[model samples]
Target: MEAKKAVRDQIISNHDIAEKFRLLADLLEIKGEASYKIAAYRKAADSIDHTPEPLSTLRQQGKLETIPGVGKAIAQKIEDLLDTGTFELLEEVTSEYPPTLRELLQVPDLGPKRVKLLWGELKVGSLDALELAIEDGRIYKVKGLGPKAIERIIEGLKSLKGRDIRIPIGKARELGKRIVQQLLEKTDKVEKIELAGSIRRFRETAGDIDIVAASEHPEDIIDTFCSLPMVQDVNMKGENRCRVMIEGGIQVDLICLPAQHWGTLLLHFTGSRDHNLHLRDLALERGAHMSEYGFKKNEQLITFSTEEEVYKFLGIQYVPPEMREDRGEIELSLIHQLPKVIRQKDIRGDLHMHSTWSDGKCSIRDMALAARSLGYEYICITDHSQSLGIARGLTPERIVEQRKEIESLNKELAPFKILQGIEMEVLSDGSMDLPEEVLRDLDLVIASVHSGLRQGREKVTSRALAAIRHPLVDILAHPTGRIIGSREGGDFDLETIFREAARTGTILEVDGDPNRLDLRDVNAQEAVDSGCLISISSDAHSIEGLYNMEYGVGTAARGWIRPQDVINTRPLDEMLKLLKRNRS
Candidate 1:
């Protein structure tokens, strides 16, 4: 919060309003009430996130209304928030929703309509009341609240109240390490650079990343940093401060402090926002400003050079960044130890990719290039089979032709390995898209159901079981085929499928596409408990899609799956050995 630093108040950009609008849309949608209104907000918000020119500049040019998703109403609201820090419409709707009620919407089972029902008929407005209703059988007493819905609600509440969204500490370390590598290549002013947050301690997914740097020459650092090709925007920049967007769209704040204060700066920015806020409150009790910069006690800025120093000033042990999300880690770490998360370097391969043989915009070679650029040792090209004809599925004969193309590409990729895998269809009869003859010929085959989701659990499980038992089905892609809210691919009974998957050594996929983050954390952990190996594969259909694997990797960690649980982390020879062994 330095004077030279960019403040949110000074930001005339539509990014802030746009972000809030989308979050509002999510809240409205999950509440399952006023969907069109939710859609309108979301459309407006998405346009802002994707805007080529900053809204700040655009408004001055008087062209905000010209954007496709931005109509006059949304444009006017954007202008209002840009000029002032409030949205009248959002405020009005939110006033009807108290904090506790808002939190309930996140549980997934109870959206806005249910919230209204609880508020109107059941006279319940908060989680506490809702819990009471369920315990008292009042929930089921309400109309449309069936036994199954009640059960789902109870479990959803448990999930909501429990410690949610954990990542493998190791994977966090990998991303942090890679960021350090990128930093080294891009900036000479980085006399020191290290992953300073949850990633440093190895968590599954990082809420945010902190890059600590010490350099006598910060101007050189800023110059090199903003000039780096991947530096998408300068969220903040100064001789002593800089932040930029890196690959995979992650925001990295590189703080240039006096080498002596490097540790303190690292601690401040490396914090969980919630944790820091709590610490700030604690500091207020002690008459201090506890911030990412330092603890400003009494009007004077008392600075620390290290995280340890800052923690000492706050009268606490240096809680690692991963545990700083205010999830009781500040108190827990004092009593016992915590589990380590996985890092990206531990990832050995990129699985669940696509080629021109399917819906992928890229050919096999193009996908390989993008994967290799990420330093992956191997890539799986799992194109769609003929049964999914709409996805330009490959016929059995064409798959043979693809094999020939793969062999030629394999030769060109001297050291790197590219596995020829097929995303085969799980036919309605519980048979695979390719016959045993064709399936056995490949290194890996991921069987998935593209249709028949409406058949519900029993038939879905039967089809999945058929695929799992198939000698050649090495992995199951996007188990449950969940398309956000619109489609549920087979409405699979995951526990049953996972139980079968472990016995057959078939991997369950965590499809990386944001649209299909299937094998979701809850189901993924079940698969883990069932002793099923999982693949956090980017069901990437093109070269651009290869990067989506990071999202899958993050989701995998949130489920607490270590690098070992994911087959894609195995080296080329070992991964191939396992799949080929399964085929035999």
Candidate 2:
């Protein structure tokens, strides 16, 4: 009886509904269905995934079809999912094909057609079976499976292992904030709530989410948290603690305590292992012991109301969460010498962005307007150059046309300038894609190697160095060309690149796109320490993308990059003057 009740009450979220649609679409494709049918399901999945209001709420109001791309049929399916936790189309498709067959589609280069081919040819329906096929050399017998393709499949499998375990910082923060927002909005039980753990530390990726909440009634808060609509299952529940598996297969632990212990609880959970251990040693030296409740000294528990108070009690400076990585932060805090790392508010402009002139979704005017809305003083329009035709790279004539539009926009949006720039590609043989005259005429030129990313260390390093040495080049964007977990970054002699970049007065970019975040924290630290100027940019393709700058700022803070170390944080005139073209 209890098992049946549990099954009936299984939580269903928008993400779960969207996943069902996506899997159904993939199954249709693998089954050789009509292209339009597959496309409809895919479109519906995207729309459902992005819809702000819960589909269950929409169903209650009989307005699910109001969502874009959600037709009456899709709405009915969604309603059925909300009511019964399963829909007809998904069941029908899963019966025809082993549900695990869809998992193969996640491997790079193994699309629905390849998955179909492998399944039909080798009876490979799961990752385990695919591995066995590879081990027995049966995979090579499949048509169109070449040596290079097989190599990519192997690497993709390895990448998936880590990808499955760690969540990108951007995704983790979004999930964490959503949970916090929901908890605050839905119930009055929570007095204070904050994201803790690695998400708090602003690491590039997070293993899991940890949230600490303060409330006079701890049990009520924990119960409310475990019952959130996004929670898929309750892993464990205690009087003051609960662990839940959220919609996207990530574990979230919520710890509730009395308001008086908020500071100690947050400090205990927002740690880097070594950072906390160091604090414990410091406490012991002071004839005290520390725990989540407070410091125990002379058999008395001394608690703090705020983190500042806790730090003051310890006779040390309050360390920012991102700097609590035990990397000389404690020593620096003791001496009152901790660097004021760059913050999001310190940013004045974005030096890298795209517009419809290239493959960007927004127009130059729209992007400029969006940046201005964010209180940005200026932005540079750095669309792709001609050689990278895949992104609709602009020709020399197109560059001239774009400048006219930028000039006109600048007049309309006074005090909010738009600088003309190009993301000029570095050819395989260490040559500039656009001519010197065209590059020199622009307000800024960002050189990057997009095509020859896999051309080995020496050749790729030479291409990068040539671009950095170019007098017209002012910044290097996404220097290593890494796409986080999916692709490996360029194997370059970064120390040499940093030295030359500093000497040539070229700034290096820390791309703000969560997937990119190139010149990641460690690299940014080494570059700034080596005297290379760094610029944090969103590399945004749309107006909403401009907000990604916070992720870049987080990465910068993790690297201990001060405001003076980043060029975009400076005033418009100072920033332009520092560019290679304006420098004497």
Candidate 3:
């Protein structure tokens, strides 16, 4: 366990070093440094970020330069970092402009150049200082900054202050998958490797990645894991446990146990913390002490090879990981009534997506073919409406043309249907972007707020209510207009909107874009409780984006959404019946 933890810490340290270099590069570029010089630091940071082998091991072996993009100078910097946890150049550069200045970049509209200007011209050294400058008219004096820019900056600062620090679950899952895949390929000693913890539970955001593996040769597995590409530092390398920080500053913990104890160990580690405690209390009542290795009952050790056996031994129905949040799941398990959460296979269609008609990269035919390939029965082409001019939102004439295109594709594809839809923007002051005539002609309509999202709570709520009340609107896409980790959702009473959606028969969308994943799990659950149907959509702009449905499914599972509660799970004929616009 100690060794495992050491490996984890080392990985984190590696990531920290790489981040410092990235920040240095950013600062240098802001200072008008030569492009090549800035590129060199960025390249080094990228190589270090993605390198398979630990930098320490490479440095000790005198092979640091063997890594792509790491020349002698960069190699030397790595050595310095390994020796003292930081390089002198970073210290020198950061002294001129405090490293904390980088936090300004967290503000939505504040880029490196603007941060640089604030730092250099106004001497704004921190977020508080920047706020002061903005309030005192100093920010307006800066070239290119106007009253509107100042207002946006104020909003951005507020968002930054309120933002949570954890990484989005999609990013955490991608990192975990990469690590698990590499571990499987690099080591034959491992029997099974699976992600555990909040990531395994499909939380909307995760603090780190936890993995459990069954292995006869634990040391070999640990060694292989610490050497995989993207392992920045190895903080621990214990006999049966390893912990490393991977690229992007996410911690990954690998705990290896004998194959017989895989189920017990996995359950113990894949925890919400509260859930595990409740389980432990229950175990005590059964005269057993449960732990990662096994259950202890009267000096006898009981271990299971499968999770079902483990759950059965505890006299409870199997609880899916996503429902292990201790929110009545324990009670449900006792009664054998755990909800059958929605799964990827249950999704029959993607109702909210875009194509080349608007901002999407793929053509309608290409998108249709991709959906067909994915075994989806149908897909909706929800191009942007004219209000979103930047996305090339469609004019009324264009909507007619696009509907004709959809009709043609439906004929060509036969049974694989293409549903015509529009992601019409909800304008401020409670109005729909396109006329009801245009919307009524479409197979589906997804109303969303694209601009003026920073409006007051009542205004935003009113805008949402107007869309929901529109008889032709089938769904609301990314209802909150939030980009995970970047911006906060518009201030609106979600429960009010959810209740209204239920009344109007308007479905809510759980956009599958990793960056969006709007209708976050908690809010989705609220919508579900309010009896609103949901549509798990990829919102795919490209063929590759179609795969985002998996993430959407994960989010739905987290929200305890079941197949019946999601309209997209219905077959084409059934779905179309629900989608029929109320012409009255």
lDDT of 3 by residue, 389-503 (tens): 8789999999988878888888999899998888998988778888888887888889998778878999898999999988888888899999888877799889899999999
Better of 1 and 3 by lDDT: 3
Model 1 misplacement above 4 A = 1-290, 295-337, 485-490, 580-584
Q: TM-scores across all candidates?
A: 0.55, 0.88, 0.80
Misplaced by over 4 Å in model 3 are 1-103, 109-155, 158-162, 580-584
lDDT value for candidate 1?
0.71
How far out, in Å, is residue 248 in model 3?
3.3
What's the residue-level lDDT of 102 in candidate 1?
57
**Per-model root-mean-square deviation over C-alphas:** 11.8, 3.8, 7.9
Model 3 TM-score is: 0.80
Order of candidate numbers by TM-score, starting with the best: 2, 3, 1
lDDT of each: 0.71, 0.88, 0.85
Judge candidate 1 at residue 91 and give its lDDT: 76
| Two-way lDDT contest, 1 vs 2, winner | 2
Winner of 2 and 3 under TM-score: 2
**For candidate 2, lDDT tens digit of each residue in 91-137?**
89888799889889867667788888888899899988888888899
CA shift of 403, model 3, Å: 2.9
Q: What is the lDDT of residue 365 in candidate 2?
A: 91
- How accurate locally is residue 262 in candidate 1, as Cα lDDT from 0 to 100? 67
